[model samples]
Target: MLKFAKYFFIVFLITAILPLVLMFAWNNSQMEKFHNAMAKSAMSTGLMRLEYSVKTNLKVQEGDILRKLYYILPNDKNLSHIKNILNDYNTEVIQKPIKTPVSFYERKNFDLYCVTLVPFDNSTKGLKISKPVSLDLLRPTGPYTIELRFNKDDAAYEFKNVAFDPMAFGPPKKIFLLLSRVAKPHYKENSRREIALKGEDNSNAAYLTIELAFGPFRGMIDSIFTSLIILLVGILSSFVIGLIIKRVFVTPVMALSKAADQVKKGNLNFKLDASSKIEIIKNLYENFNDMILNLQTKEKLRESFISNLTHDLRTPLVSQSQSLEFISQKFKEIGLTNEYELAESLAKNNEHLLKMVNLILDSYSFDPEKLKLSIEKADLYEIIEDCKEQLKPLLAEKNIEFVNNIYKGGTLIEADLFQIKRVFINLLSNAIDNTSGENKYIKAAARFEDEEVLITIEDNGNGIAKEDLKFIFDRYYSGKSLERKLGSGFGLSVCQKLIDMHNGQITVESEINKYTKFIITLPLSQHPGKGTKEQP
Candidate 1:
């Protein structure tokens, strides 16, 4: 059953949790993809809008510069060489008119450079400007905008761009390095799509190029709350499902198991109510009830047979005892010791038979419901002596002496005389039987303690085996050396039962091949009445 429950839990977890786990995994992967897609989409859309905004700044404007540079271009041989190259420049120095007619040289690439000379203007007289004009003021643009220039010279690219910041979600923002990695600049046509990265080139024009940096999006579905919600739902659902299974299946099976244990212990008088809606459980209960009914019926039949047999046998045993007593009387009148000894043997046999019949009835009917003890006040000393006399034939046969060491004056004890006498007879008889081959002596003695009478019966005979001593008084139990004189195999059990009836105890101490002692403790003033009574 334990193994079954473990398997049930394992299977339940697997079935219940598997789909949730897969769903969570899929959801997580999709969320990551979505975050990336949103980042690119947002970047592309924002960059397009931003470029239009930069274009609409309304700050930079183109103007004619030919008249200002006409003398320098037509006369100077160095500037006349690349007239088209010189024409492309929107030169602020010529328009703003700075001191010394500042000559600017741009490295086209390698040792080749585009050097242009702007001599004094043809129309304007030679004059140096009073104040220095800021180059940034001449060419205006926004903070995010960057402009780069390229030439066919030693230096391929002229650095004119500013660095971008890292990505940040809120105030106290940090630089966004999301699209800040520097890669070899390549031109691609403007197209809106999800990309691995985000950045823009306003035009493919050479010499001067404008770049706009955009970033990836951070989206909502990639949050910790989504995964947390999924995890919590999965765990809670698994536990709830487990509990439902336990209540519906495991609990009922365990209860059914408990019922089986009671039946195993031979208790047939129990009511098992497996009144469940489950079909199998209902059928199991039905079969259990039937088994109990069958057992009860068979037990009744067996008890009835034994009860009738014991009752009928007792009558004939009484007649035989009478006949034997009559023969013994005749032999005694003849003063024949030899014949009297034989008579004693016959009498012993008869007594043994009677004891057997009574033991059989006691063994069968000894439950609390059927047990009745005929209580009375009797002398302990007389009971013990009578028990010894009852076994004299067997004692003589084995040449075993019976010593009655009980107090000379009788001690009045409250007990069931019949039951108590049987206990003494059985113990002494057992001692005599065991001592037969060894030619040993049997001693019976008694004394009074503060509140109990302790009677000790011991024999110098092959004692009970050590392993057998513990269960020697259990019903139907026999020691290996027991003589089976009572033939019913319940003599010691009956002895124990009778002593218990008087609110007393019986114990045995023994050593193999040495001696065995039976100690019976009876209350000195056990109030004389049946402690309990019932009908079989």
Candidate 2:
């Protein structure tokens, strides 16, 4: 399920976020292209307008020169050369100039530029101009109009016929380079066009060429900022969507998984707390709760049935055991040889049966309330001796040696005497069952360790395998051995439970074909709050 959630998150992010990212990239590219094209167009339009204005100013200047020559001194021989130049101007005058010679003429809105002007042959004298005119005084109408201020030292200079050197203007404005970059191939220096002005005779035409400087538009979109914002929004949206998905789907499934684990570990009382908004998950949680409840009911019924059945079978088996013992005694008294042997054999079999029945009742009919301990100071050495004496018949049958290494006086411990004795009996019985070959021996030892008594039961006969040690005390987990298989597999589980009631620990260690040892540690005295009904 965790893998499924991860897979789902990856697939969802791809589907929800991939297309948006692609679209943003493509749109940003297209927008950049469009903005560049628009900037180029704007630059071209600026250049065209500059060129048209320069041409119009040049025509006006030519008309003013011609009017001064044709009407002001039409027949003056000294200015006849000027008339001849006016006749060769090769352009119609668009502006109406005064018939009389104007003292000073200033056309501040003119945009045409030239390094030198040749109005006529060398015989004609040039017109006088004022000192130091600003270069920007020529073109005053445009999106970007530059006014070049004259320095104090430059104001001493003068020009002829309003003509000035282009060098004195210095380098062009910084904006021209930016404009050129944006326009590129469309607005280069070579693209500048010269206008031809012709007279009525259409001969000896004068030419006007002007350098055009385009203006820049610094209004391009900020694609980086926009892309960042798009990316941020995309991430935030994906996170919100992913969170919703996990909350609505993944969380409930994880809860169900945890609850299922608890149930697998034999905890039927665990209930899932699923409050899902999704309908299907809600139904699933409800069904899971119902299943657990049903199992609990059936488990209780099965336990009750086992309890009643064990009780019913225990009564008859106990009675049969007593009757068989009496019949064996009576047959022995008559000394009916073969019949007496049969009775003894029957008595042995009946005794074994009775033990099996009692084991079932003790193991299966477990009620925690009825299994409370009778906590008191008990003699540990006495318990070990009693277990040994009770299993003496089996020890004699197998010819196995029993070694008790406890201090003879007695070792005292706070525990339930009956449960502690049962623990020892179970450990010894297990040791005896596994120790069957020649030179078989069982050893019991105890010692004081801090505030606890450490007791061990060891057997020298074919020891338990290394792999079976961990599960030796688990319910119904008898090891793989011929003698181990002969009895019901609940003895060690019962021993472990009884030890836990005394707040003690039981552990086992073994090596294949060497020896098996069961170690038990019990507190010398129970804790202050521990009582007969203490819960472990």
Candidate 3:
């Protein structure tokens, strides 16, 4: 479980951390775009307000200049005084070297008359023009004698442009100021657009001008602040998500895994809590608990069945054995030869049957903790010969060869004589049941090796399949082929248990259609250790 959790946590971290980092980066990018868009929107609104402010100030300035020009025009005073004042105002206030020029014109028959009070060259202030400038060059359109038109040639004129005469014609009609730019050469290309006045008619018109200035855009959000916000959100989200997964997925799965291990180790009472909110996890826990409960139920039924079965069979088998021996002795005393032999065979068969019943009882009631051993030096060959004698009828019926290959004096093993004899009987009986055909043989062999007695019971017969080999000795594990007529599936399990109690090991080697061999290794002396007790 420790190893599994370690590796699973690594996988979880990879799955969780990588996506969180990617989401953080993507969210940061989106937030930056939104911040820039809001900043631009705010700047656009500010630009509109700035344009309005410039228009209002330009209107007031225009009113003052118009008043000065009007006084000079009607009073017929020398325009030089007002023109000089304009030049001074332009140089000091407007920050330009020349004054705003004004042209005067009056309608005449089919043509127009125009004169400039201040020349474009600015050579002399209020220089009276010798000739009229062309009125058509201004392209005056609509009811306002001075019309505002955008100049494409002057790219810096982001606002509208109005070309008009700055000097007063007469004081009579409606007038308004317009913010606009003048065409190039007269001012720098980057200069702010000029503001000029519009009049309803030529009878009483006065025009004045000023420059409009606007500020640049300034973004509001800080880069570091945006990054901090993203980081905080990412961390909070990761924490919440990680907590949820641990509660919903990881914790429940680990619980189930631990529970499964306990069940495997014969702890049928172990269970897991089944009350999870997640549907799949809840179902999983519920199923695991249900399975453990079923196993516990089955185990109880099995133990009860074994107890009842052994008690029912053992009593009758013991009585029948005693009765059969008495009958055999009576038949011998009456001098009925054939009947006496039949009775003797019946007695032997009855004894074998009684032994089988006892074997079943012992196998069912086996417990490692309650094991008792009568360890003594006994002949292993004598035990094998006895087991063969018990199974001699079955061997003769099948015309099989029974080969005892033990050394002359017989190998001795420090073990319980009865348990060792039972092991040989179970093994030799299994070999006899499986072996057939004319040349079939069951071989019993033993040797002393490495301070242990190695006993082998082999058969030339249909060998065990590879799939069944691993589970061959497990209780109630019946292989596909070795179905004994006597026991259910406890023979090998019993043999293995008996060998384990003697501080010994039993193993099997086999190949399909070749040969099956059972190898039993027992220490020359029963060592007082695990699975062994002092023969008190």
Q: Pick the candidate with the highest lDDT.
A: 2
Model 2: residues >4 Å from true position, as ranges?
A: 1-266, 276-285, 465-472, 476-483, 528-536
**Can you write out model 3's per-residue Cα lDDT over 1-536, one digit (the tens) per residue?**
67766786677667766566666556555654554464454434433444354344434444555565554543443445545755633321222233554434332333333333332224333333313223233322211122222232322222222333332122222211111111001111222233322222334222212222111111112332444466567768777987887777777777888888777545677878777778898888888888888888898898889778878988987888888788888888988889988988887788767766776677768776676777777777777788889889889989999999986566777888877887888888878777888899999888878888888889988888887787778666677655222245678888887888887899999888789999999888877776555566
TM-scores, each model vs. reference: 0.42, 0.51, 0.45
Model 1: CA > 4 A from native: 1-293, 314-351, 361-379, 408-412, 437-439, 446-450, 479-487, 527-536
Identify the superior model by lDDT, candidate 2 or candidate 3. 2
- Which TM-score value belongs to model 1? 0.42
How far in Å is the alpha carbon of 272 misplaced in model 2?
2.6
Write candidate 1's Cα lDDT for 1-536 as tens digits. 77888888888877888777777666666665565565455446545554443333211211123344445544543433334444454222234332233222233232212222333444232221112112222222322223333331222433332434454232211322221122111112231221111111222222323333232222332233455577778889899978987987798787777777766544669757758788887888788888888888997898899989999998999899999898998999999879988987898789878877887886777674456665566777788778777777678878998888877666888776777887787788777767766457988888889999898999988787777877777655665655323234577777787788778899999887788899999898766455543222
lDDT of 2 by residue, 366-401 (tens): 544466676777677787888889999999989999
Local distance difference test, each candidate: 0.60, 0.62, 0.61
lDDT of 1 at 386: 80
State model 1's lDDT. Answer: 0.60
Better of 2 and 3 by TM-score: 2
Residue ranges of candidate 3 with Cα displaced over 4 Å: 1-298, 317-357, 408-412, 447-453, 481-487
